[model samples]
Target: MSNKIKKKKMKKRWKISALVLVIIAIIGVVGYVGLQNFLKWKAPELSGEPKVGEWYRITPEGTKSANGKDWHSLIKVGKENKVIVYFFGGGLAVDEYTAARPLNDDGGFYADYADVDFGVKFGIASNNKENPFKDWTILAIPYSTGDLHAGSGEYEYTDLNGNKQILYHNGYINYTSFMKEAMKYIPNPDTLLIAGFSAGGFGTSLLADDIITQYFPQVNNVTVAVDSSLLLTDTWHDVAENMWQTPKEISDRLVSDNITLDSLTSLSKKYGNKIKILFGSSLRDEALSTYQSYFRNGILSTTNENGDIYEKDLAKMVADLQENIPNVGIYIWNEIEKNKDGKNLTPHTILPSPNFYGKKYSEDKSIADWIVNAVNGNINSYGLDLLDK
Candidate 1:
């Protein structure tokens, strides 16, 4: 063969190889795009509301006295005609938190609380150890920024990726302003049981009195259960008074704080006999030491110079109520800690995930049984005598 002829053949072979490589690359890109689209299309169906679930989102604007914030609430109505309204705590600035909330829309993280369901069944067992409600309706609200609620000012907005969203500024006020507006939908106050874990629990205590007096005067007739809450004590009661002070008007003398212990005590009084305050505590809770120092001293000292809190002094409160009030049911579960270092170190933080620390209270039947007792009105037997002393 001639030299030129051989060179031509080699060039043709190289060109063919290059063309084949280009074709393979195009096919690979097409397959990757299709796979991503398929996953995106299927993700929504999985995240949609469960068969027995109902979801609601509420935004309460700030009022005149209190600057409002936005918050998300999820109220899951159980099988039995009973309802549990869950208040979730998240975000530093109100707008940024609400903007990334999971209840309204499904992102990478949603329904990460003990209340939500897993594939096989609900992750958290009921007090009865059986799912009581036929259905559950969840309400989510953004309680931090006024933009979400009726409070004054605005909050900075951040994107889904945690990038600086829109910079917004809003006046700071606690969640009472938001709760007051939420009372409009008490959902047949008679059958409602208000409960929250962590920050939601704090909000429950803050709103318990109002819900009792203003919305559910029959709170004595119903159950108010809280899990992993009642830790941080607030200072002011209503936007108006502080029960710890002799004059009640002394709230004005204090600096601006969101919640007060006096408010919780006074709120506890309205439906004294009817309201059932149940606490779920973990002895080794990593945040316990920090919260005890920060919130206990911070708020309790202002009003209760003696320095009292539900965790440390629960026995005394139980006794005092037993001595005076009738039919005041209280249950306390001293949850055993599973991990020493705290597996869910950041569970309580605004960032949500299933990585919880302490022990798993949901699967424990004892915790479920206690809840069932409260539901059936049999909780009066839980060492009422202990509270008496």
Candidate 2:
């Protein structure tokens, strides 16, 4: 063939190849987006009896997230009759300003909805041998409603953009609704653990009494563990009563800004030594300090000064709990991580993090080991001296 004819054919072939490459790229992008949506919204049906050691997502009817999306929970059928009801943690929205912006909106205050696969791979929810609750049947409750899993009201507030919005703070309704369905699979338990982290930790303190008295009353060996939950606001009682519309029993317990302390103290008084109560926290949790700064100064900050203030508040909290609830088991750790500014800050929560099994309170005991001991009724406090550092 002549040189001109050959060059013309080569150019045509190159054009066709480029077009095919663009088409292929478009298909790949479309497929990836579709898969993500599927993962986010898909709810697995609990058709037959749940198989042993398998995780299943259960979406109960009439349950909704803070953003009005359908809410679902997770369960893992276990080898033993013992059970762990774990509440997952997200941030909170105390008022109109915080409510307008959710975690997805870069508000940094609260998560508007729960993801199906939130905490399945770490801490107590994991299948790792190091997890003491690994084989225990787990009913994992995901948090989204900003009410710490204890609200039953719809709150209307004006957003930062001056748009009126209604937040469905339906945490209480979601938990009860899903627990009713979860009971069908793991009906009766000889030993039970009700636990949570961060906002869910506060939920553990607030809802443990009602949950035990209502659902698993017959389980004698009951334990409640609250991890890394602290929020100091003088208006908590009013917020609980009017904004969240929590049950009167829960609302009544919120006489002070320290809801975790109030709830746990009251629960201790009611249950006596019948149930194990455990609490865990890092010395200077960065995320919690940020929230505390917002609550105290009306500015969200994670400065070392804010962290010191959180530590001071934590010391007071620990002292108050020890004074009021003598039997409560405390685990305080000083696990440091660098913040965005490269300053040292203790992490927010440990129970749902890899550090649950990796970090140790004593040279001999991992946090996992301490938890296992508490579950077996050997209640003791660890790392109390860390408060001074």
Candidate 3:
């Protein structure tokens, strides 16, 4: 073959290869867009008048599940100027296919919650007369993505069987969606209380900065409350960052010095005294500690011959959080009234317990009193408590 002919053939092959690559890229992008459009959820109708004190399953924006399935938030409208926004408690998981979240409108995210009824003590439960926040407009968010409610990446999770599943970490997206709709109901609230438990607590912390800086910059009476989502579980911190796309989703909004996935007080550490944060968790949170084993079972054993090894880890993490965050206090539950497991101290989430409103933190005060004091702008930090045995 002539040298000129061979050179021409090589050029032709190179051009063909380049064309094929470009075509594949285009197809991939188009396919992604098509699937997204197909799965996009519409805003649920929010025009009906909710009964004064009745809880209703209403999706202000009709926030759909990551896979376009039905998901809902529990809403209760009130005539008060104060508002409380809460997130439900559900275990964070890589195997969310079997995770406990509301798969439809019939059930609630919490085991004890009803579709349109209000329970007392939980972040969402403010229906009792003993609680000071009873009259505040309540908006309780539900978790579905199993991303600790703060992810923004489209990632893949591999189950125990080596099967890969694509997941949409859309917690941050849902936050924006719900917030926009929420403002319509509680616009210009005189007092805003934000709290969540377990996975939802992490979500509250993840979005707290923005909720203050961006959403309601003018609302000075804001208290960020956390219930039992001990972000200090260092074993799965990196996994959560990578799998949930934490850095990509919330790093810019965090906007502070050294706010990596390694930091236990990522939100409070950055804001310092500028933001008021209240944290709560039981020392012997069996359910939370048990769930922790799923992610760090081989790495950090929770149980040993002497006691739960994670206790040390939890202690250190809590201490570090106290030292790092300047304007923060904690409502710790070291004792439980009832110990079904026969352990010395049995407690998991403090807010969900009736103790949240009834247990005496002092001679004449309760957790609800502390919450009211915080909400009233009488801000003070350095709180660590133990419920009376």
Name the candidate that leads on TM-score.
2
* Candidate 3, poorest ten consecutive residues by summed lDDT: 11-20
* Stretches > 4 Å off in candidate 1: 1-52, 58-80, 90-129, 134-190, 216-220, 230-264, 295-327, 335-365, 380-389
Error of 3 at 300 (Å): 10
Highest lDDT among the candidates is held by which one? Answer: 2
- Cα lDDT tens digits for candidate 1, 1-389: 43234333332111101112222333454585653443232111223333344433333343221122232233333444445544443211122333333222322111212212211122131221334332433333323331212123333344557675432222123244445544554455346565544444455554555455555565345555544433333443322231111123223432334232333344455555456655443322333333343334321011121222333444544454444445544544333333453332111221011112212233343444555567667664342332343
Candidate 2 achieves a global lDDT of 0.80
TM-score of each: 0.48, 0.88, 0.70
Count steric clashes of candidate 3.
0
> Lowest-lDDT window of 10 residues in candidate 1?
11-20
What local lDDT does model 3 show for residue 115? 27
lDDT (Cα atoms) of all candidates against the true structure: 0.35, 0.80, 0.54
lDDT of 3 by residue, 1-389 (tens): 43234333332111101112222333454585653443332323456666666566666454455554555666677778777777765545443332222224332122211121222223236566776777888877766666666766666645336676555666666666777766765657777787776665766777676677766777767788877665333334454556667655464443332222233366666655556677666666655554454334312122331125345545655566667776456565555434444454334555544566777655455666666777765544323433221
**lDDT of each residue in 1-389, candidate 2, tens digit only:** 43234333332110101111222333454586654553455335677889888788888898999889989888888998999889888877787766776775323567776774635656778787877788899999888898989999999987656788889999999999998999988767899999888888999999999889989999999999999898799989988889999999999988888999999999999999999988888898877887787677566666788788888998999999999987788888886778467767786777776567866766567777877788898888888888877
Supply candidate 3's per-residue lDDT for 375: 71
TM-score of candidate 1 against the unseen true structure: 0.48
Arrange candidates by lDDT, descending. 2, 3, 1
